[model samples]
Target: MGGFGPLETAGPVLVWTVVLTFVFLECALIIGLFLPGDSMLITAGVVLASQVSGEVHVWALSVGTMIAAIAGNQVGYVIGQRTGHHLVARKNGKYINTRNLTRVAELLHRHGFMAVLVARWIPWVRTLCPAVAGAAGMDHRKYTIASSIGAIIWAPVLLLIGYYAGSFLENVSWLMPAVIGTLIVGLVLGTIVGVRQYRAEMARPAEDFDLDEAEQEPVADSPWRRA
Candidate 1:
């Protein structure tokens, strides 16, 4: 009852939609990086695998995910070129804060394309790398090429892992719940650790800013003051 309803239960079209959305969001932002995208892909593959009696093409979902991921990275790169620096300046901007941007900038300066490629798997860094690429003024052509290769490899590999796992776990229906449960647990743990680390990082002095508290002080009872 809590599963995908009719619109998303259709054949290739529905599966394609799911794959595309998952990849796009996963590559587009840090929040998506922690989503159960990997698990969902595997579940889709396993479910679709047995239904391959005729019209469905399992690889279609995999290919669709790759396309979405690559496109997302490109979008992120363009956004970074335009706003990576500004994001750090925005109030309450926790995701793309100054420290993260500085770290990404250093990586881009040092490693260039290799940095983007390697960051494809690291959840926090994945979303930031493409934007950092643009901020570093890397050649658009090179960025596109490197990002395309990385996305193609990263997206398919994750889906394939899920596909293979689904195949192996086919006869054991009981294991499905266990796998999903374990993934949820892992996600919770990762989130807790990530949040703690982020808080700790943010708690450190903003070395670059000596913001004047008097000029920007909020009124009494204001939300900003409360914060």
Candidate 2:
């Protein structure tokens, strides 16, 4: 708690709220494009490691963060399943662009479960992948299995890194600033890369959009499409 004096004294409830809300919303909604979930998780880990507050348990934080991430993705998937195509149809002034949705759909078709697993580490993709999987009519079982694996791997690894760093730097006041600075720089860079990828995806031609199997053959399978 050397240089993290104030953080050590900070209330656990506030910390929990900040961490959980950011992680949850970042996964559950398109707002994740702008939010820095990685940074938040790492910061939470550091704070907990610094023992800034005894009330914050590393296990609890890790588990809670994982749950929030998984739950958020589930919500996003459901939203995509229910209203994805409608949103695409009305994509005139919506935040969810049809082009990007189509691009995501294509990725899902190409990579299947792998897309969900890998996207968990890629900022904007992580938020959009689940929705795309749903909209593409990917098997729910496959999506859930892949998403759960990704969440389990992603949350704990970062949190542990921060926890270890915090423990190592607990006595070194000067090193804390360097760690904090590095995290800030990483967050900025990640956001820039994520935004660029998103823009690139949105710029893809409409012709490249992937239609569902039923959509590809509408009249022949109208009942199947509705089902």
Q: Which candidate is the best by TM-score?
A: 2
lDDT of 2 by residue, 1-227 (tens): 65354554564565587778878887887767666788877876776765654324767887888899899989988987875454342234233555556666656666667878888998867887777666656678788888888989998788877778778876787887677557656766776876675465455443323345323323321211233
Report the C-alpha lDDT of model 1 over 148-213, residue by residue, as the tens digit. 888888877776676566556655766744654565466457656665755554564443311122
Error of 1 at 93 (Å): 6.4
Error of 2 at 170 (Å): 1.7
Q: What's the lDDT of the predicted structure labeled candidate 1?
A: 0.59
Please state the error at residue 221 of candidate 1 in Å: 54
TM-score against truth, every candidate: 0.66, 0.73
Evaluated against the true structure, the overall lDDT of model 2 is 0.69
